[model samples]
Target: MKKGLLLIYLVLCQVYVYAQEDAWVYLTDKDNTGFSISNPPQFLTQQAIDRKNSQGIAIDNRDLPVNETYISQLKNQAGITVMAKSKWFNAVHVRGIQEDIDALATLEFVDYIDFANSSLNRSASNSNRQDKFEIEESLIDFEYGGTQNQVEMINLDNLHLSDYTGNEIIIAVLDAGFPNVNTMSSFQRLRNNNDLLGGYDFVDRTDNVYEFAGSNHGTKVLSVMAGFVQDQYVGTAPDASYYLFRTEDVGSENPVEESYWVEAAERADSLGVHIINSSLGYTVYDNPNYSYTPSQMNGQVAFISKGATIASEKGILVVNSAGNSGNNSWQIVGAPADASKVFSIGGVDASGAYSSFSSQGSATQSTLKPDVVARASSTFVIDQFDVIVNNNGTSFSSPIMAGAMACLKQALPSVSNEQLKQFTRMSASQYTTPDFMMGYGIPDMQMALNLALSVQEETFGELKIFPNPVKNELHIQLPSDTDTTLMIYDVLGKLVLKKSFNSTYQKINTSSMISGMYILRIESSSGSKTFKLIKS
Candidate 1:
């Protein structure tokens, strides 16, 4: 009789373990009267509030933190595992069995229960093979192959020449995982300078992102933005600060990953990230019912796309990759990329032609999808082994464009995110007639900077400055005779020279200034204009 009871007990234990699965328990409300949006500092970083203030974004209920009372009540429940929480949707994501889920539904605060993945299966990234595309040697401009050319192709180096290397800007990279970034020699500078602001593994519910076992795809992705190895390799925004987030589950494609993504994005916003670069996307899932139809790529249909749009509405610039399905039957971009607010990126070749494998856009809504394109085929990046190599996909293209955008943001901090988007689209090669393949072609960063400068110069028109790399003298040309106060400050923001003059043309002796970058602030009765002057 005792032996029979032991057997029964073992059977019950097996059933208990097998019964548990992943499900989401949606809470109706926070139900906390203590929290308020007026007290933003209690939840959001000052930098986050500053970004919203600068962009004219108002603080709302969505900015409020999740109710701790609801969380405490859910935590006390048995057989329920809370995975993540989202303030935007006012929901809690949990993993539990059918019986426990049913019990939770009976609670007064429980709104409903939704299954994230009823079937225990992994949703893998489809067609994500790391195939090395062939490259013609003749098309290569530098020893670095398409990596250096990609920067020059878009005139991104011009921004670098102006010393805008993404300094002071924070970018959050949301992907699968970063394995070697913590130990890679190529990332030594980032590690030594303390630019790698640390990371979190949402999938495992751990803070040890570096020690976890994950795909190297995220390592390569981040290298395209922050990797630097002197003349051997230079990323687009090598000096930018970064926060690494592992949201993708390399083994699975499920609605849970979407929730994880939204949670990560919300965290990034609260931490004051200026930009988010996400190479992950969602379309098909293991469960047919959860898979999204191509018609659903209208941006509003996908949960991830909606979350991405909300992130943008909160004044964060989201950059996502257009999926790689050009040759497949899907032949279209994925969610979040379909969201108009996202800076969706597609792939191109060194020859400025759209890659045959790059995804096409224009949602079922018939709106242009990918905002721009960058070199993807034969795109160069550092591998896990610390070797410089080429890879293919819209994944590389997205970060390439994202890094350059960060550099541009550093250069023009006063330019609002929306204005920057408009200037960027206008700076594209095919802005006049953009199609699905390459929304607005590759953007020219120099052109965008010039356009921004022109707008800044509108208040004081027809002003020409010459001898940019000046050693002794600098000349200014005015459209008409006007009284002006010219103040020149060094890169350190120290005033070097101050002069008041009234003339159509004036020559200022710059011999006394040191050889470096100087800010020329020209203030007149009409307005003030500032120019970046290089002294050689």
Candidate 2:
């Protein structure tokens, strides 16, 4: 009996290595048109694409096996608990004893192997960055809205645009609970569209999460992501689909909540959730031993954070809140948000400064956290009864930004998630340089879309408008072996130049043109289209 016990313990220790042998995140092996398994519909192509992005791996370069040969070997073997036919990464997710893990690292195709246990549920990430700009805290009293942003918060015409709206994209919002959300008038369109996919309650370990209420955090979260209340407050992407997840315990402090987050994330993946907006985080927990040290911010200590990272690898864009400890002594960011793979979001005031209460970092492991920021302090949300309330914390900031990402995703459906992230960063308020407070800075989604779609200046599809703020010289591009048309118009909607081409390329010398706001429209038969060209 004693010897048997020893053997079992040894097996558990080595299982991870063995299990990892063929497990990999297949980024380049995508064929995603759609999915239909659960809430958001589980899509592998999406998940894998996300993983390839954070690793700094090029989308094309993502094809290399995290563990290449071990995958083939495991597929050939017969006794392994897991078997392979075809896989997300061209590798299989193997099940083995702890004794197997070491071997996994040696596998050629194996990038890194992690337990899949946590993916089923995950906690909301916490608030992190704070606005550097400080104003009267009561900006909402006179403002009535929330934080005073240069761009005032706008409300959606939910009552008026009920059936007629251009928003049709799927946006998964991972929050706490949806109590009364189903019965609210504000959420009527969401109910009508049946846009909400099924969700799991990771907190109480039961599905009746909606019934148990408090501040109805989840309801408020949904409102911010997709609520439509005219003249009051509006979410950035109100028309997007939603999958509400309950992963936090507004009541407890046990360290176990992290596990719940992991569980939620797995479910999100299985559902092929387009975007996961988790506004919870872990730094200190109920257990004294559980309180994470700054080192744990590396993104490897917590199961939920690791799952968040893996989810990103799988192509599901995960936007997480940093933490609300920015004003505290331990102002460093929290777990999962620290996960190098996830997009860590910070809170900022309208002036584009970091929120004082937003957490800070460059992570210990995957440093350079809080990828972006949004209005957090003094933000508005809807309670369970559909009443609007102003709140503070990075929690409010995450959904605001997530809403924007959904719109961006809808606008640039062809760009890969990795490209989208990169493009957004490049097009940020501080792309050329970065500040610790706001990271890469805020994003200009439409501008990002334009840049992503822009053809190389030297290439035919490349459309160039030169002489900015200029009195002359507007140039056009012509690519080889392609049909082309270039049209220019002034701000007054006057058509300035319209040309049809039979040559590989054409150049329009705007040198003889007037300087003002101009729009250039380019269209291609290959389903390629771009809009908004500035002519100076």
Candidate 3:
């Protein structure tokens, strides 16, 4: 009996060794055919092209699709499972035996083979269940219910009141799965208006995301953004369009999910998604050997981090959860959340206090993370049954902030993705003294929008107003010499002053004006310019 047991043990060890041979092959270059930057329609949607043109972003080789010939030939192989493909890295992820991985290196198009899995030793215990810290659930009558606190906490209600409901803005949500979203009443408006674009279940290689048997985390996460049920609960961006993507397999954690996320991001870019909300983060894995160390939390280390950064560079706003590991032994933000360009959101309570389970960061490489905070404690989200459930975690916070960003985008469509990030950070309450746990602290959507408006006015309008809080005199500078008609009005739209001039520089006297705020509109041959002015 002892001899038979030893034989079985040896065989198991051999199988484990073979499984460890899975790798990702990076190709040096792609075969140039059928794709061109000048002709973007072949691989990019018109919306995507328009976004690039609006931002003055140049389409280059990175926008090109991966060589289909190479992918087709690779798929024909018997022993390999083509898990994911990345256009940004020009690589293909595969699961195979040692012999097959070794054979891939010899291919002429292959650049080099690298072990995609981390080499760190995994813990003997395979189970590492993450705990979620949530506060009490409070029920209320139909009318924004418990969700009103979250929107008010971030000051996004002001924007909502302004009628900026993220109309015409496209957001792509990448998560585990979105089960029951199609039938949920909260999503009825989305379906009625065709706001819910088609989605895919990448884990199962199917386009039926709603029918897939998976976690309901995605449905809840998305509810924080697009769900609406009269006064019971209303998401931040109720009018925004969405594309749901299932990139995670909750049963296990491995490098393959990172590849799946990259593939989804690439698709989002091609479809002209303006924003991507990812409530998923990675760290310890089922296979200890595939887990990432804290030191590897640098923005450039993880594959998902790199992918998120590339997505941001492509003019797409990428928002990620900072992970719910703050109270655990591994108390730090996860990959993709550590990415510099990715807006990592932390969780706080309605009273502006940090949640105990919100991940802290300044990565091991010492870069501040959890770029901003949002109310997640006892946050209201729609369940698969279309019921509001109070929950907590950065997962809830991420979508809340993402929805706000969609509104901000709708208000300032010309602001570049990078500039949007800067504006949000600068508008945060703790911008000048950000801490590791909360980074820039909670951001104010109204403040961020105001800042973005200033930037856009300066960039396009080319009109400058000095001494904004003018006591008696106000000056306006136009970009060029043209006939200009200036009109000033009170907040109620009552005209206060009107003047005409043709010089590039002009000044007006307002010594008798009362102390208040007014809107200054300039109509010229170039265009119409509006400015918010204050009087002392």
Candidate 4:
């Protein structure tokens, strides 16, 4: 009887020794590549190349795909199963026993192995994994119906009236399952117009993104940008094209989802997507050992946040939800939202008040977080069942802001993503007095449009505008002698100051002007020039 008990105990020990753990295998190089940066068509689409060219971004080695031979070698290893691969990071996400994973480090192509369990890896850190899809109660004009308040609060309706409704722009939605979006009545217009492009389920490694059994958080998030019902409801960017990507696995909280998200982001970049809306944030995880500490909230620490910053550097306008942990002990924005380059969005109510549940910015980071706020309280969204319902969370607010950004992109195709973010911040209600909760506060889409338009008309050569964000005085210097008429208009298009000068320099008193963005236009016989002026 004692011998039999010993045998059983040995069998249990073997099982425990072989338990699978998630990890990322970093490859040393992409040595065997047939693609060249000069011939970008070999890997990048024409649209993507054009976008990079327009933004003055060069195609580099980072854009190259990972070595498939390396991936195959890792897969052939004993007990190792490759899950997701990222070309941007030159790494592959895998699952295997610790012994098996560690053996991969001996391969010639393998750079190192990062275990998902932070305790196992010395240089690696984990993310805080929260339920980003949690329902919160929370649009745009043109019979916006339940969405009128949300839309008008951000002044997106004015842009809609001006015909800047996101035409010819593409936005990718990265989230959980989007069940029923392919068959729902609320998405009928998108289907009929062929605005619903293709999508992929990275979590399931499938092409069908609308058939998953996970949470329907993606369905409602997309509705805020693409759903439409005549005379009843209209999404913020109803005319924008879309690409759905399911990167999150709602069934469990794991670091592999971050790899999946980066993989999806790479696909979006390859597909020439102009904007990416990720209504998700990571904070705490199911495994306590993989949970991130508050200090890791710095934009560069988390893997997902690093990927988000790379996506932005690639010229994609990456928008993320700030998180819904404001009322909880974890009262700070999560990964990707904390990423410096990402345009993080926060939540607010109908009265333009901060939502109690909107995540706050970290006191450690120098950059302002929750870059701007939008209506998230009792915001209306179309569920998987085609029913209009009120939901709450930054998930809804992020999409709302994303749709507005699409319209702005359509209106100012020449503006870079960084400039777009700056213009949006300058147009916010609290640009001069931003806070942790609201950041720059609610954005005025019309004002942002005006700011972009004014900057686009800068034609005067050698013209210099100084002391911008000026306190009490503004200075201007011209190239040559010419009778120039100067006029300053508020963001509302209301004339605030007018003067005519022929000298090479001019100064204007701006002490009495309210702190905000204004357009300074100068006209002469040569041509008209416009400058974006800020009074602080």
Task: Give the range where candidate 4 is weakest over 10 consecutive residues by summed lDDT.
Answer: 135-144
Which residue pairs clash in candidate 1? 123-252, 123-253
- In candidate 3, what are the lDDT values of residues 1-536, reduced to their tens digit? 99999999999996775485446788878666578777899999999999888888888888888897887777777677788899888989888775677677777888977665544112122337454323344443445356788998888999999999999999999998898999989999989999999888888899999964657889989999999887677899999999999999887667889999999999999999999999988876656656677767888778899999899889899999998888877778888989888899998988999988899995374468889999878788877877777777789999999999999999888777777777788778887688888989999888778766653323236778777556799878878888989898998999989999988888899887876567888888778867776655
Who is ahead in TM-score, 1 or 2?
1
Q: Would you list the rank order by TM-score, best first?
A: 4, 3, 1, 2
CA displacement after TM-score superposition, residue 524 of candidate 4 (Å): 8.9
lDDT (C-alpha, whole model) for all candidates: 0.80, 0.59, 0.83, 0.86
Report each candidate's C-alpha RMSD, comma-separated, in the order given: 11.0, 11.7, 6.8, 4.4
Compared with the true structure, what per-residue lDDT tens digits does model 1 show for residues 1-536?
A: 99999999999986765465556676777656477787889889999999888888998988887787887788889977787888887788776776776688788888877664433323322333322122221223337344668899889999999999999899999988888889999999998889999888889878877754547778888999999987778899999999999888877556778889999999999988999999877877654545667777888877789899999999889999887877777778888788888998988988889998888885474468788999988888776777777777888899998999999899899898877876787778887688999998899998778666654322346887876556698888877677988998986889989999899899999887765556889888778888877655
TM-score of each: 0.77, 0.61, 0.82, 0.89
Which clashing pairs does model 3 show?
A: 122-288, 143-231, 143-232, 144-231
Model 2 local distance difference test score: 0.59
Give stretches of model 2 more than 4 Å off.
1-166, 213-215, 363-367, 455-458, 461-536
Name the weakest run of 10 consecutive residues (lDDT summed) in model 2: 150-159
